[model samples]
Target: MPDFKRGRSFLRGAPAACLILFLAACSGGQPSAPETAAGPTAASTTAAGAPAVPSASGAAPPSSAVPGASSSTRPALSKEAQMETDRLLIRAAKANDPVQVRKLIAAGGDVNAKDDIQDSAFLYAGAEGFNEVLKLTIAAGADVKATNRYGGTALIPASEHGHVETVKILIAAGVPVNHVNNLGWTAMQEAILLNDGGPRQRETVRLLLEAGANPDIRDPQGRTALQNAERLGFTEIAALIRG
Candidate 1:
C-alpha cells in the first residue's frame, strides 16, 4: 500500500471516469452526508436463499429462501411490498437502526433484494458507512462480497469510503481483499485513488497489503499501487510500499 500525490491539475483533470464509476459502484451510489436514518437504498437486491443471519465468522446459509414464503407454501413478496421493504431497509441502514432491520429480516424481508438499480442492502449499508447496519445485514446473511451492477462489491465500497471498521469487518468475515472488478480495480487500488489518504485510508492500504494485496499489482493501465500512490503524491504511502 503506497500513496502518490498528483498536483491539483492532475487530480482534477486525470481521466479516471471509469475509475470513479468503478469506485461509485463499489462505494454504494453517490456522495452524501452521513445519514442517521434507518432504511435501505435504491440498490438492494433480493437475497436468493434461506435468510439466515451470518455467523460471527461471517458464514451464513445460502441466499435462496424466498422472502415471505413458508417452507411448505412460501410465496414471494409482491413487487410493491418488496419495494417498500427496500426503502425501509435503505432508510434503516442510513439511520443505523439495527433493531427495526432485525424485525424486517425476521418478518421475511429479502435481505438480498436489490432496489431498482440493483444495489443490495449490504452494498447500501457499506456505501453509507453504516457500520451497525452493515454488521446487521451481514449477520442477517447479506453478501459481503456481492457486486452491484458495475461489479462493485461491499468490500470495495467500504474501502473507498475509508470505513476502516467496516472494511475490517468485511475482511475478517471473508470478503476477498484482492478481488478485482470489471474495471480491473481492487480494494487496494480504490484506497489509493481516493485522494483523501488520511490515516484510515492508509490503514486500508495496510490491511489490503497484509491481506496479500500486491504492492506491485498493476491495473489494466499498467498502474501499480505504488504508481497510483506516487501519482497522487502520497509520499508516506510510497515509502510504506517500498519498505
Candidate 2:
C-alpha cells in the first residue's frame, strides 16, 4: 500500500468523523509576516479538557435554549442568533483565544464557520498553532477535511511550516499527506519550497514521508520535494528524500 494511507488513526477521544479545515496546516511558512495573517494554520486539540455542557437546556445557543420551556414553547433565536455566534467564533479563532472558542461552542456555534475569505475558525486555529482552540473546534465536530480558498487541504500549509507535531496531529485526524493544491503542489513539495529548508522543515518532510507522502510529486514548475530541497541547498534533506 502507498504511504498516503498507511496510518489510519486519530488521536484517541477526538471524534474520528473528522471534519477537516484546509491547513500545520499553515499554507506556506510561519504566518508572522505581513501575508502571514492570511495563509495557513492547523491544530489538534484533545477533548480531555472540554468543559462540561448541559443537556437540552444548556446544549443550545442561549437564544434558543430557554430553561423550563416545553418543546413547542422553546424560544428559538432567529437565524441572526446563529450568525452572531458564528461571528464570535471567527473572532476568537483569529485571536487564538481558546476560552472564547470553548464558550462559543458551548453556546452553539458552528465549528465549521468560514469567513469572507473562506478561512474558517477551525482552519485559523490549526494554521496558527492554537492547540486548545483547535481542539475545541474539533470536539465540536469541525470539518477536518475542509478546503481553503486556494483549494488546498490544511495539511499542505502545516507541512510547509515544518510543524511536525501539528502535522502529526492533522494526519492522525485523517488529513491526506499527499493531497495536491490548486497550485499543483503536495504537502511535501510545499515544505521544501516555502521553508528555510532547516531542521524543522526536514523533520516535517520526514514525518510526511513516513506517513506515505509521495516525494516524487511535483509543484507547478515540475520540481519535486527532492529537487526543491537540493536547489535550495538543503543537501541533508535532499539526500534523505533521495533515499
Candidate 3:
C-alpha cells in the first residue's frame, strides 16, 4: 500500500462512536475555571480553562445553571443520580434544546459530563454540527479545549464533522487551532488527515494560519500543511496557503 500518512491522510482522531468513550476516560480531568460573577462580560468556566462567551446570534441567551440540591454543604452524588443527570444533559444537547440543557446544568449536570465512552455535551454538539448547543454549552462554561482520550479537542471534532459554524464558535472561544494532541496532530492536521477540504476546512486553515499557525510548522516527522495538501492533491488549500 502507498504511504497515505504523508499526504492525503485519513482522520485518526477519535471516531464519532468513540467520542463518548474518550470523554468518559478523561472526565473531570482538569480543574474547571474559577466561576465569575453574573455580567455581560464574555467569560465562562470549563474543565480546560476559561473561554469567552459567544455573542447571542438571536439564539436564546444562555440561562445560568442553578446550584442544585448539591449545595456547598451537600454530599456527593449517588451513582443513579449522576447517571440520570448525564442522560438528561446528553439528550438535551442531542435534541438541541438549550432551555433543557440549562436546566440540567443548573441541576448540577456537569457542563462537561462525559458519557460511558467519554463524550461530553460539547463534544457531541460539535461533532453533530449543533451550533446552538455548542454555544449554549460554551456560555454555560463547557471546556472548549478539553482533549479526549484519543487526544481530540472540540476543535478536532468540529472540524472532522464538517461543522463550520461550530468550528468558528470554537475559534471565537479561543481554541488554539495549531494545538497538537497526543498523536502529534493539530486541528489543521486533523482536517487534512480526514480529507476534509470543504470551504469550512479552507476557512479553518485560513483561521489557523492567520492566528499564527505556521504552515511551515512541521509535525514530529517534519510534515508541513503544504506538504500534506500537496500530497493529498488539495490544490485549492495548498494554493490558498501558498498565496
Candidate 4:
C-alpha cells in the first residue's frame, strides 16, 4: 500500500518550491522593479502622421524655412555692380535729375565715388549749382572738403559762376573759404577775375568777404585781389575789399 500521509506532505512542499522558481525565472534571478510608461521619442509619429515631438529646446524653425523670409536678406552687391551704380548716380547728378539721383542712392550708390575726371556727384552738383542734388549729396554724407580735378572746392566754381545761393550753401556747410585751387586762385579771386563784376559778382565777393576769405591771397600772376579789382575797375568790389 502507498504511504498516504508522506505523499500528502510532499505535495504540499511542491507548491511552495514551484512558486519560488516561477518568481526567479520572471526576474532573471533578481528582484523586479515596477516599470513606468516611456516618453515619446523624436522619431515617434502620431496617428495623423505628424511629428509627435518637437526639437530638443522646443524652439521654432529657422528663418530660412519661413515664408517671405528671403526678402529680408539682401545679398551684398559685387564690386562691378556697385561701380556701375555709382557711375549712373554721377550721371544723374550731372544731369541735375534729383529723382534719378535719389533712386540710385537708395540703390546703394556712393555719393563720394569719383569718375574718370575725378568728379564725384557731390562735387559736380555743387560746381554746377544744382542745389537740389547738392543738398541730397550733402545729406548723404559727401565729404565737405573734397577737392575736384583742379584741386578746388565746389565753392570756387560756384563763385566764378556767381551762384550766390550755392556759395552760401557751401560756406554754411563749412567749406574752407581761403582754399586756393591748383591755379592759385581763391574763390574771391575767381569771382572777380573769371566773371564780369556785376551785381551777382559783387554780391558773391561780399559774401566771400563776410565768410572770412583772405583778400591778401595772391594769384599765380602775383597780384592781390584788391589790386586786381582796382586794375579791372571793379570800384565797388575794391571799395568793399578796402573795408
Candidate 5:
C-alpha cells in the first residue's frame, strides 16, 4: 500500500530492459541463418558441366543441346528408291562417266549393286579396263573379292583381255592372284590361253607371276600355264613360266 506509483513505473522499465536484453542475446550470441540466393540445382546442369537452360517452349532442351552429340540420323531410302539409285549408279559406272558415277555415289548409291547380268559396277569396270570408273568404285568401297556371273573375279576376264594396267590395279586391290574361275583357269593361264601371247599379254603373265600366281594351276584340259605357253609357241611367256 506504500509507493504504489513507484512500483508501476519500475514494472514498465523492467519490461523495456527485458526486451533489450532479449534482442542483445539473439544478435550477440548466435546469428540467425542468413537468407541465401537460390543457385543452380544438379538437374539444371548438363553432362558437360554447363548450366542447362529451358527452351523457349518451356520444355527441357533436346539431347542435341549437349556438345558432341549427334543431331539426327539420315533417313533411310525406300526399297524402290534404293534399287533405282543403284541401277543409275551401275549404269553410270558402266558408261565410264566419272562425273555421273561420282554424283550417284554421293547420292548414296551402293557401289556393290549388281545389274541383271549379275555384273556389278566394280566387276564391269575392272573387266572392261575402265580404270577411271574402277578407281571411283574402289574409292566408293567396291567389294574387291566379289565375283561375276561366270563365277570368276574381275581379274580373270581382265587378264584374258590383256589389260596389264587393270590387272595391276586389281592385284594391288587384293584380288586373289591364283583364284581359279569356274572355267578352271587361273589369270596367268587365261592370259596365255586366250591372248595372242603379245607384249601386253606377256607383261600380264609376268605381272601375275610376280604377284604369286600358281604356274602349276591346270586348265580344264589339265594343262599348266607353262605347257600352254610352250604349246602355243609363246617363247618369252614360256621362259617367264620357267622362271
Candidate 6:
C-alpha cells in the first residue's frame, strides 16, 4: 500500500477526493477482520483453522450417536445470543469443559452455532484436542461436516493435529472421508503434513482410509500424499499410502 503523499505525487497532485481513494487502495490487502471478539483475524484463518490452542501435533480439527441437526436445518441464532453463546461455547471448548458445554447447550445454546468466523463448539474442541468436549458437542448436535471460514471441515484440523480418537469419532459420525477444503488438502494430507508420520498420525490416516477416504487426491501443486510423505521422510506413512 503506497503512502497517501507518495500516491498523491504519483497522481500529479490529484484532488482531495483522489487522496481518499488512495487511502482505500492502501488498505486493500486482505479481507477485513470480523467485528467480533470470537472471530480471529484473516491472518489467523490462513493457518490451519485458526486454532484456539495448539494441539500435540499442531492446532487441529469431531462426531457421535446423537446426530446433530444439520446447519441448514437448525434454526439460526440471533446475533446477540449467538455472540454470547460463542463466548461460552468457545470458552468451554478451549478449556475442554464438557460440563460447561453441556450446561450451556441445555440452557438453549445451539450446538451447530458459529462464531463470526464460522467456527463452532465442535471445531474448537477438535482443534484443541478436547476429546470429551468434542463428544459433548457431538451428542448435543454438532454437525460433523460444519466448515470453518476456509471451507476445511472439522476433520481437517483434527487430522492435522493427529488426534486419533477425535478423528475416529468424526469418521464414525459420517463426516465425508475425502472432503477437500478450499486449499485442496484432505484430512490425510493434513495429518502427514503436521506430523513426523508417527504411529498416532498413522492411526489417524488409517481411520480415514478405513472410512473410505481417497489416498490418491492431489494438492493444488499436484503433490500426492505419498509424494508429500516421501519428501518429508515419513517412511511409515509413505508405505501406508503406497500400499
lDDT of 5 at 131: 94
Give one digit per residue, the lDDT tens place, for model 1 in 61-105. 455643554462213567787678767876666577888887776
Compose the digit string of candidate 5's lDDT tens values, residues 1-243.
235465556557577666555555645664444444754455757767897787899798776685555343322466797799899989998888989988888877888999999988899999999998998888888899899888899999999999989999999999999888887888898899988999999999999989999999888998899999999999999998887
Worst 10 residues of 3 by lDDT: 65-74
Which of the two candidates, 1 or 2, achieves a greater lDDT against the reference?
Answer: 2
Q: Count the backbone clashes (under 3 Å) in each candidate.
A: 53, 25, 8, 0, 0, 4
Cα lDDT tens digits, model 6, 49-141, are 743553466734222222443354334556686668767877777777888887887666766777777778888887667888888888877
After superposing candidate 6, which stretches have Cα over 4 Å from the reference? 1-83
Kindly report which residue pairs in candidate 6 clash with one another: 60-127, 60-157, 61-157, 61-158
- Per-candidate TM-score against the hidden true structure: 0.64, 0.67, 0.63, 0.69, 0.70, 0.65
- Lowest lDDT sum, 10 consecutive residues, model 2, at 17-26
Question: Distance from true position, residue 13, model 3, in Å?
Answer: 98
- A best-first ranking of the candidates according to their TM-score comes to 5, 4, 2, 6, 1, 3
Once fitted onto the true fold, the runs of candidate 5 whose alpha carbons sit more than 4 angstroms away are 1-75
In candidate 4, what are the lDDT values of residues 1-243, reduced to their tens digit? 335465566556578666555556555675444343654543566656787655467776675665444342222356898899999999999999999998888887888999999999999998999999999888888898999999999999999999989999999999999999999999999999998999999999999999999999999999999999999999999999999
Off by over 4 Å in 4: 1-76
lDDT values, one for every candidate: 0.73, 0.75, 0.72, 0.87, 0.85, 0.78
> Which digits, one per residue and each the tens of the lDDT, describe model 2 over residues 83-133?
898899899888988888888877777878788898888787777666677
Model 3 residue 213 CA deviation (Å) reads 2.5
* CA RMSD of each candidate after superposition: 34.2, 32.8, 32.9, 12.4, 12.3, 24.9
TM-score of 1: 0.64
Q: What lDDT is reached at residue 79 by model 3? A: 73
Report model 4's TM-score to 2 decimal places.
0.69
Candidate 5 vs candidate 6, TM-score winner: 5
